[model samples]
Target: MRALGPLALAVLVMLPRLTSAQFGLLDDGLTVQTGREVHGRWASVLHLIPETGRFFPAYWLTYSVIWSVVGTRPLAFFVVNAAVLASLLAMLAHLVRLAGDTRVAVTIAAVAFALSGPAVESFYTLSKAEPLQLAWIALSLLCTATAAARARGSLGRAGWTAGAGVALLFAHATKETSVVLAPIALGWLVIERRAKPGHPCAARFAASYLGVAIVSAAAFAVLRWRYAALPLGEGWYTRAYAFDAATVGPALFRIMAWLVRDFAFLLPLVAVGLVRDRTRGPLLYASIWMLGWLAVYLPWPATFEYYLLPFTLGAAWVAGIVVGDLWRDRAVTPLAWPTLTACALLWVSAGINAAADARVQLVVDRANGQLVDVLGGLPRDSRVALNMSPINEYHFELPMHLVEMKRRPDIAFVRPTTAPGHQGETFLVTPEMANPPRPTVRIALHEAAVRQDRAMLDGLIASGAAERVYETTQRVGILEFGIGRLLCRVAVAPILDPTYCPTERGLIERRTFTYGWQVHRLVHARPIAATMRHGG
Candidate 1:
C-alpha cells in the first residue's frame, strides 16, 4: 500500500506518452467534433445524433471540458486520457483492498491492469469511451462493496448505496455496454447473502441496488427513445457481425481464442488466490464482472480488442490477489518455483507487447504527421479526390482528416468516384496513380502505400503518363534501434525510389512508413481538337 501510490503515479505519467505517439485522431474523431460544436450548449449536447447511436452524455461532457481547455492540441487529449486511466487504476486498487487482499497482492493487480495489452490499446487510442466507462465501473464496484459492509438503515449505508447507483448511471452514460454490470453486481450480492437466510441488511441492500439499476436503465431507455432515434440500419462496421447461423461458429471461436490469449498470464494467479484465500467473494466478484462482459460482447457481431478493456481489468485484479497470497505465504512449497516462473514469464510477455506497440506507434505517428502536413499544404478549396487504401495505418476515412485539420466545410474533399466520365478540375491524391497525365503532378506519397502498389507505379511510368517531379526523403532515426550505420548505408539503393524511400535504402526502406499523397491532374482535350484531327 505504501509503495502503491508511487507505482500508480509512474504508470499514469507513462501511459499517455505510450498512447500519444500517433499524430492524427483515431476513431473518436466524431465525438471530439461534436463536443467542439456543442460546447456550453446544453440542449445540443443532451440530444444523441443518429450517427453516434445511444446518448453518451458523460463522454460528451468530458470531451467538452477537455477540448475547451486544450482546443486542437493532440497532446492535451493524451494527457486527459492518461489522467482518466490513472483514476481507473486508483479505483481498482481500492477494490482489491476492499476484497481483503494483502498490500503485495493489491499492487500486483493494479500494475497488471495498467499493463494489459487491450487496455493499452484502448487508452492509447484516446478516442473511445471504454476508458471512461471502466473508470466509472470501478467506482461503482467500490461503492457497492462499501454499501455491502455498512449496517442496514444507517445513513452511511444509504449514502454509499446512492453513490453506487449514481456511479452506475454515469457508467451507462459513458457507454451502453455498461448495462451488463448491473446484473453481474446483482448476482454477486445474491451469492454473498445466500448463507445468511433472511438477513435483513443483505436483502435490503440487494433490493435497493436492483431498484436503482432498474430505474436508471428505464430512464435512459426513455430518454433515448424520445431524443435519440435509432438508425434504420447499422453501419457496415457494426453489421460486420450479426446473429447469423453461418458466422456464429467463427465468432464463438474468435471470442474463446481472444479470452484465452488475453488472460492466460493471469489465470494461474487467480486460481491460486481462489484456493488460498479464506473468502472467495472478491475473486468470484471479479470473475463474474469479467464473464458478464464477455457474455454480452461475444454474441455481438462487432467486438474488437478495445471492447475487452473492462474484462482485462477484472483479470488483473484476480491475478494480483493470487500474487499477493503467494508473497504472504511463509512456507516454501512445491508450487513456489512454478508460480515464480509463471509470474516472470507474464512480465516478459507484457514487456514484449509494450515494445511491439511502441514500434507501431512510432511508425504511425511518423506517417500521419507527414500526411497531415501534405494535406495541409493543399489549397483549402481544392476539390481533392482521395483514393486511400481501406486499411491504412490509422484506419481513418475522410471525416477524420477533415475534423483534425479543421478544413473548410465548403471544400469538396471526397473519395474518388468509380463512375466513368467523372472528369473535372480536381486534385487527385493517391498512393500510386496509373496513367497519370504527362509530366505528372508530384506529391508526397506514403512509403507503405507506394510499396504495396508498386506495379501501378511501374505501369504509369512505362506509359509516359507519370514522371517524378521531385523527391523528398526524410530519415526517422528513432526507428533505428541499433546497427544504425549499416541501416544508413543500405538506404542509398535505387530499388527503393525516392517517392517511397527518399533517403538511404537501409534507413528508409521499411523504417519509413507514411502516406504518399501523389498529386495528379487529369488531362482533357478540347472538343475542336478531335474534330480537326478527324477532318485532316
Candidate 2:
C-alpha cells in the first residue's frame, strides 16, 4: 500500500536527475576528490578535523571511499543519489501524514519539495550531502516523536531517545547546517508528548536528548573554533569571523528568488489561508520550522543557496497545507485558478530544476572528454601548463589529473613555467578566460593582482613565442541562454564574485553565457623578460 506512493514520488522527483548527466564538479560538487582523507588513507568517519570550516566527516568519508575504491569515474554515484533522493521524499511525506495532514496534503508536500530549487541543486550533484543530511534529520525527528509518544521512561524509551540523538549526530556529521535541527528537535519532543495525553510525559527521555544535544553542540563549537577559524574556501564561509552585514542582502535575494520562482502561484493561496493560520497546528509548525531555518541562515556567514534546503522544506510543507485546504472546492476556492495556477507554476519550477540538473553536461563534462582526446594526441612526455580562464568557475583540473592518471601518463601537466627558464613548454589557454563582463560591481575584490595576471597572459601570447596547435569551440551565447530563461525562470546562486554576476544588475544581461573551449597548446620556451607589460 505504501510502496506505490513513494515509488510514484521517486519517479516524479528523479526524472530530471535520471535524464541529466551525473558527472561531478571540481569544487564541492560531486567530483571534488583530491585529498579526500588525511594523507590519502581512510580515517574514521568520526575524524574530528573541521576541514574547510565545516564538520562533514561523514561526507568526506563517503566520497573518499567511493572514489578510492571505484576509481575516479564511478557512474554508480548517480544510482545512490537517486535512492537517497527517493528516500528523502518518502520520509517527508510520512512526516506530513504524521502531522495529521490528509493524503492529498502529503502528496502535495512531497511534490513541492522534490521539485524545489534546493532539491534540484542538491540532487544534481550525485550523492551530494544536503539531500542525505536532510534524510537523516527527518529520521531523527521521527525517532524523537516515537520516544515521546510510545516510550514511558523504560529502557525502550531510552533506546528511542538515544536513537534520535544518534540520528541527529549523523545529520550534523553529514552537513553542519543540520546542527540547527538540534534545538528544534528538543522542542518538537514536547509537541509529540502533548499529542499523547494518556501516556505520561517523556521528561527523562527529553532530558537525555538535551544532554546529548548540549555535548554535541559544544564539541562541534570547540572543534570549529580551534581548527576552522583559519581560512577556508572563501572569506564569508569561515574568515569573516562568523558573519558580516554585507552578506545578508545578497543572501536574502537568493532565498526570496528561489521561493518565488518555485512556488509563486502557491503564495497567493498561502496568503488567503493566513486568516485561519492562527488556528491550524500544522501551519504553525511549518511556519515555525521555516523561521527556525531563517534565524540560523540569515545571520550566519555561509550564503550558498543550497543551504536553504531546510528552509525550502518548511515552505513546501506550508504549501502542502494551503493546497490541501483547497484541493476540491471550486465553490470554496482558491484554483480552477488555485490548483490550475499552482500546477502551471510547478511546471515552470520543474523546468528550472531540470535545466539546473542538466547544466554541467552542456560544458564541463564534455570539455573533460574532449580535453582528454586533445591531451592524448600530444607527443609523449610533452611539457604542458594549464592557463585556465580566471573567470571560469569550473574546476577543469580534475579531468586533466584523470588524464594523467588513466590515459596519457607521460604528458606532464605542470604549473605555468612563466618565470622564463623552462623550455619546450606548451601553454593550454582557454580564450574564454580573457573575456570580462561590464564590471557592474562598485567594489570588486583584489583588482591589482588579477589585472597583472591577465596582462602577463596577453603579453606571452602577443610576443609570438608559440602558435596555437589546435582548438575546438562550442557556441554558447546570450540567445540560447535567454531561451532557457524564457522556458524556466532561474534561481541564482548566492555567490559574491562580482566578476561573474553582479548583485546590483537587473538580472539577465548577456549576449553569451560562455563560449566553451577545448584548448590547444602554445609551446613557448623564452626568457620571461618580454611578458611584463600591464594593460587591460
Candidate 3:
C-alpha cells in the first residue's frame, strides 16, 4: 500500500509530459477570445449559442478557469489531468481499504486500473472531466458504504451518508452518465431500512437524498432556462441510439475486442470478475454496480468505451476484495506470491505498451499538425469544408472559438448528392451548369497539384468556378477569376463509377451541389434556366 504513494507520484510527474501530446488539447484552450462574452469558465462556448442546462457548472468552471490561466498549451493541460487522475486513483485505493484487505485488494485493483489501456485514452488523451467525476463517485460510495456498515443507532451517520448522496448528485450533474449511480443510492437506502426496524436514521437518509435530488433538479432547471423553454433532455443528441439486449451482443463483442486490443494485460481481472458471479458484502455491491452500469449504458448511444470508467472502478474494487479475502483466508496460500509476481509482470508490460501507443498517437498528431496550420490560415469567415468525417471531429475545440466570436464560416464542405432530390443544383457537377440560364463558372485543378489528398479542397478547386489559390510547402499562388473573365461552363463530368453504389445503378455520377449552394444542378435545372431567360 505504501508503494501507491510513489507510483501515484510518478503518474503525476508523467501527466504533464502528456499535456503537450494530442490528448492534452481541450475546447477550453480555443475559447480564449470569447471566453467571457459567452460565459465565464462554463461550457457555454462548446455548444451553439442559446446554450443552457448542461449539468455540473462547477466541473466546467473549474476546468475553464484553469485553462484560461494556462492557455491552450498541452503541457499545462497535462498537469491538471494528471492531478485529477492521481486523485482518482488515491480515492479508489482508500475505498479498497475500506472494503477489505489493504494489500491484496488494493494491489489487484491498482494493477487492473493501471493495466487497462483504454483508460489511457479516456484519462490521458481526452483530458475530460470523467476521471474527476469517477473519483467523486468512488469517494461518495465509500463514504456512504462506510456509514451503512456502521448504521447501529446513529442518525448522525445517516446524515453523513446524506452528504455522500450530495456528492454523488454533484458527480451526476457533472456528466449525465453519472445518473447510473442513482440506483446504488436507492439500493443503499433500501438496505439500511431493512437492516434497522423503525430506524430514525432512515428518516435522515431519506431527507438528505431528497434534498440532494431537489438541489440537483433546480441546478438542471436553471441551466435549461439559459438555453430554451424545453429541458436539456429535449436536445437531439440525447435521442441518438444506445444499446439494448439485442444490440448488447454486438456491444459486448466490441467491448471485448477493445479490451483485447488495449487491455490485454488486465485479462486476469476480467476473467475473475466473470467467473466469480457471487460475492458477499461490498464486493457484491461493487459487482451489482458494475453489472447495473453495463445494463444501463450498454444500450444507450453513450457506449463510447470511455464510459466504462465507472464500471472499471467498480470491477477493480471487486477484484481487490476477492483477492484480498483469499490472501487472508489461507485458501489461496503458497501460490499467493506467485500470483502476485505474475500480476506485477503483467503490470509492467501493460505500462510499456500504453506508453508505446501514446508515442504512436503523438507522431500521428504531429503529422496532422499540417492540417491544423492550413485550417487555421484560412479566412475566418470562409468555411474550410471536410468531406470524410464531420469537421467537428478534427476541429471540435477550435470551431467553438470561431462560432463564439460570431465568425460563422460560410464554407460548408460536404459530399455532393448526399441528399436525394437536392442534387446537381446544390452540388457542382452536371449539364445544368453547362448552359445555365444564370451565370456560373467551372474551376479546374490537377488532382496532384493540391500537394495533399484533401479531396474536399481538391473538388472545390476542380469545379473551375473558384478562383484558384494553390500553395506548395513554401509559397502561395493566387489566380484571379472574376465573373466577366470566367465562363459558367458546368458540364457532366463523372467523378466516381456507379458500380460502387449500393443501389447498383449503372451511371457515372458527377458530384452534386455548386459553390454558393444556390443551385442543385439537376433538381433546379429548369428553374435556373427560366431566371436566366428572363435576365432576372
lDDT minimum window of 10 residues, candidate 1: 527-536
Report the lDDT tens digits of candidate 3 across residue range 1-536.
46467257537545534644542224433434433443553555334322243445545555557656775555666666666666666777777775446676776777666545445545555346577678667667555555655656688666667677667666765666666555655665555455435445444444445445455555545554664433545545554444444455445544443333333434454444344433344554565577666766555532344566777777667667766655564454555455545555655654554454344334334333333444444543333322222223333543443343234454333333333343222322111111110111111211222222244334444554333332212111212111111111221122121111223211212222211111112222222221111110
How much lDDT does each candidate structure score? Answer: 0.57, 0.54, 0.46
Residue 316 local lDDT, model 1:
78
Q: Write the per-residue lDDT of candidate 1 for residues 1-536, one digit (tens) a residue.
A: 55457355646646546554543435455656765787778577666565645567877777777877887767777777777777877787777776578878777877777766566566666567888888876776677667867876889978987787788788888887787866976886776577456445445555666666776677767666676645423533344435554445444444454454445566566656567644355577677878888877754653455777888888878777767766666366566568757866756544344444444444444555565555555555555544444344333434455545556454465443222344434444445322111111112234445554454435444654444432223322222211122222344332112222223334212233232245554232222121111110
Off by over 4 Å in 3: 1-7, 10-13, 19-56, 68-71, 145-159, 186-233, 241-249, 259-280, 325-353, 367-392, 395-536
After best superposition, candidate 1 residue 232: deviation in angstroms? 8.8
List, residue by residue over 449-535, the lDDT tens digit for candidate 2. Answer: 444554555666687654667665444332111122221234343433233333433334444333334344555554443343221
Candidate 1 TM-score versus the reference: 0.76
User: Against the true structure, whose lDDT is highest?
Assistant: 1
Residue 11 alpha-carbon offset, candidate 1, angstroms: 4.8
Q: How much is the lDDT of residue 280 in candidate 2?
A: 53
